[model samples]
Target: MNHFFRYFVVGGFSLLVLSCGTAGDKAQAETVTERVENVKVSPLKTLQIDREINVSTTLEGYETVNIAPSVTGNIEHIYVEVGARVNAGDLLVRMDQNQLTTTKLTLANLSHDFERVKALSETGTVSQQAYDQAKLAYEQTRESVDFLSANTFVKAPIRGVISAKNYEDGELYSGTPILTLTQTHQLKALVSIPESYVPFIKAGMTLEVTSDIYPDVRFPALIEMVYPTIDASTHTFQAKLKIPNGDNRLRPGMYARTSIKVGEVNAIMVPYQAVLKLTGSNERYVFVVKNDSAKRVRISLGKRVDDMVEVFSEELAIGDQLVTVGQARLVEGVKLNIVK
Candidate 1:
């Protein structure tokens, strides 16, 4: 009876040990099963890529004029205030007549002396040298008077709005600018494009421009000027576009974005959403399916058109399935299940 009891106890212990071992084996097998992520992918393709470049710049006045008095004097009267629209040659300010009046008085005296000296010299009453001196003095005084007279009435140089007023009536002019006039009927957008695009950009090319201030408005601008020289350090060239602000709604110093169209080319294009930027770095990458596994590929990006982008990579080839979805949860060498 003791031997049977011993055998039963040992058998029970052995069965318990075997059960634990089987359970561990089952759990281990489950843990080792390859974790496959279900993803949607599209094959890369070669298409005629619309190579367009976008540049941001500020809108400047086509013509900016600074108004100031040529001679130092007191501002007598201001005809226009800020935001007042004026035409070219419009009288904007009038300086005090103190300098102009005094010059005219001197000119009158010089003229009287000149005429008297000429008459006396002709009659042999005065020397030729004295007559010549009086004539020269009169001419010089007349020129001074003319200069002061023209400057006394400060006129607008350009037909535009009065952007600024620096002085009021009865203020002394210390050679500071009294007003700033900007031509708002037409504005210019200066953009610096990559030097490689210089050969393709022409002076008459039409480009699309948008302003932050006018969000819903997109206007066409012509490339009025393209700088001949390229900046060596920046490897960029400047292009000026004429933006017509006929309504006088656009102002200078507003931010503008310009899109220039380059000719089409055959290139590998992918969806813009497929491109992923790695954390803590500027490097861009995308996942592609290779032999049923996800392969992360580093790529150089070019101009993006709408939802698609131009991409270049030595490791990538045409018709390779790219994993656009489920990429956020994928890593290099992860197994993939292509799903519809």
Candidate 2:
């Protein structure tokens, strides 16, 4: 019995010693955590930083025109194909018009007869009634001749490359866009501005644009037009910026990002991570340290670019040191340890 008691007492003392060591360890951890939870804040600084806002957009043609058939006829020949570079009045397509040629020949004969009759009337060999009738016929026949010749030939309206051709040779084409030619020398960046910004948008202001297709390329643009009124449904005003695409790099239907200078002012801004998004959405909070205790400050946030966010609220003043590096682990009235 004495030996069993001795064994039991020794085991119990060992267990007690182990519990005490664990408790000491836990208490030390709690003390270290308390010290580290302390926070520090500095005054905010007012800096004159150039503000840049990024917008998503695409490049578009300044002017797009469809080459619809002005005269009715069957396609006899196609002089140009897609991507063919042509100047104004260059032949693009031709229509088969046997009847038109025949009509022209008939008109020519009538014109010659009418001229002879007019000459006879001047010589008093023909009656005035005959002369007047012959004169009218001659003018009418001349117009017919010109019309027929035009119907047989298809021509380019301006200097441009044929981007599209809808009709094939021997296909009947009438009043349909046989080809689409665009002068890509100039491009336009289209954008819609909110109603609040309409008054500030002025023509001749500069714009900068970029596109995903050409990541390294930036096109200098100018404000071309601002619509006079706002769209009722969208509550936005339409705006356009012109870009010189003489190199043909900026094509129609290309996605572009456009930036316009709206306003510039000095505002208080801090590191992006300093502003906290609580509840994961619209709620914004920032930790401001006062006397080693972190005060959770709810801030009204504005434009942000890269790692900095603009804090517009009056609660944050210039030269106020913000806890930028370590803010996520803090709560209201929590303490933080400033490592730096």
Candidate 3:
């Protein structure tokens, strides 16, 4: 009976030990099976990306004109000064009136003589040749008088600000420009874009320009012209942008930076943190979390704008969850616990 009792006790202890080992194995297996890494994920989205080129530039006047008298005379009256605004056909200066008065008197005498001779010719009292001579002289004198009168009042050719004024009242006009006018209602922005971007640049493309002078203002401009040829040395092409400055807020000499949208493409954009560079190869990749598993997808990178980067991959789809944070510790097919 003692031997039987001892054997029964040993079997019972062995059975208990075996049960404990089995339970421990099951727990270990469960722990391994349930292992997962917490990661922050963001859904990949489709974005319309505009490829752009940024260039520094300076603003210029839309149109510049020099105002000068067509005839030689002494300036009698000055109507504008530097920085004065004028419109087309507005009188800017007046020439001496003595020349105009003399021409008018001569023209009046010639007109009276021509009419008397014309009436005589109609009455058959004067020769046709004499009448022709009087008419020609009168026409010539009238033209000369009209020319003198028109030049007496120097007018603005364009609507703009008088940027320069050289002569004043009583100044002799020696065929020199009296004033310089620049159109400020519209401005021009000259930007040099890379030659590679020349093909994509077209007229009417929108440009966003910013200036240090107006820190809070972003001036909108349109691509007005694209030069036909590129600069051989710089490998760059020049593009002209028209900026509307009807308020005259933007000056011609102001320094500016321009952003031109050269082209556009549909791409998958993700946070900067999601893209990773491989340790050895030059390949870039991102982790896509699908069905509780991490998938490694190789991608081609395009333009980067701020914190977002454009990625192209055949395996990536819009709305797919991508591991943005905690992806460094992940491998392909690894289980994921998506967190915020």
Candidate 4:
């Protein structure tokens, strides 16, 4: 009888322990069932947004010219130095004028001989061939003088500032330029655009440009040229923009950001916070509530306005609930407890 009581008590304790373990597990499971994440969702809506393209490029002078005399000669004097502002027709350099002076004296002597030859020919004392020879010699000498005079006086072809002085006074000018002139009052920038935008971009289209040096200023730019051919390697076309820098504040080689409005696009607009970037990649995604569960949708982003951004995705539709808040904690197909 004592042995039976011991066995029965031991068995009863074992049964109680199993029952308590089962009850504890049931309670834990119930608690886990109540732990759904609370999120706030906004219904996606379609809106018309301005589609803009942004590209970075370096600024350039409107006109950049390397000024050099046509004929090779000794540079007698340099009238301008680096940073000197010059106008059109202003003499910038003077080559050796010894050749010019000698040619001019020869022309003068030929003129007198030609006059005497003409007088003789009119009186039949000199032959017509003699008069023709004198005239040709005089004309040829005069042409040489004119050509020498032009090369001796090197003038600025455009109104601009001298950016470089490659030669000094009493230096022999070979093939290199004497000076580098650049028009800085107006600037230009070449931007490469994707071939897809060729149809939308046209000459005279206005764009907004900003430089890193002057961050707050927005200079107005106009599309001055559109290249006819697209680069086969890059699959992009080039566009030249004219930016007015009347104050001479902007300089060439400065970094610039250009923004152009291609047109309007219809896109699904969502709060900027709703988008999340995937770790270790440039891929972006968003979580939307579908039938009380979070659904992850990959999206391609477009232009962002104020607090909203444009997203493109075939998986998302108008009126779909997007989780703007509490998206970080959610995962694919996780149960959602949406709150206001």
RMSD for all candidates, in order, please.
12.8, 13.9, 20.6, 13.5
> Going through the candidates in order, what is the number of backbone clashes in each?
0, 17, 0, 0
lDDT score of residue 273 within candidate 3: 80
- Residue 117 accuracy (lDDT) in model 3: 97
lDDT of 1 by residue, 125-156 (tens): 99888988999999999999888877998888
lDDT of 1: 0.87
Report model 3's TM-score to 2 decimal places. Answer: 0.60
Model 2 lDDT, residue 268, Cα: 80
Runs of candidate 1 exceeding 4 Å displacement: 1-47, 112-135, 212-216, 229-235, 265-300, 305-308, 311-340
lDDT per residue (tens digit) for residues 1-340 in model 2: 9999999999999999999999999887676447566344456776565554456666776766687655777888889888887888988877877867887787788878888997898899989999888888878877876776676786777877778889999987867788888877788876887664555689998977888888998888898988898889766787878888878888888888877776775768788777888785677888876666677778766567678777765566666568876788776655667655
- Candidate 1 residue-pair clash tally: 0
Candidate 2 residue 166 Cα shift, in angstroms, is: 2.0
Per-model TM against the reference? 0.63, 0.61, 0.60, 0.64
Q: Report lDDT (Cα) of residue 180, candidate 3.
A: 87
lDDT of each: 0.87, 0.76, 0.85, 0.89
Q: How accurate is candidate 3 locally (lDDT)?
A: 0.85
Q: Candidate 3, which segments miss by more than 4 Å at Cα?
A: 1-49, 120-133, 265-340
> Which candidate should be chosen as best, given TM-score against the real structure?
4
Candidate number of the best lDDT: 4
Between 2 and 3, whose lDDT is larger? 3
Query: With candidate 3 superimposed using the best TM-score fit, by how many Å does residue 324's alpha carbon deviate from the native?
Result: 24
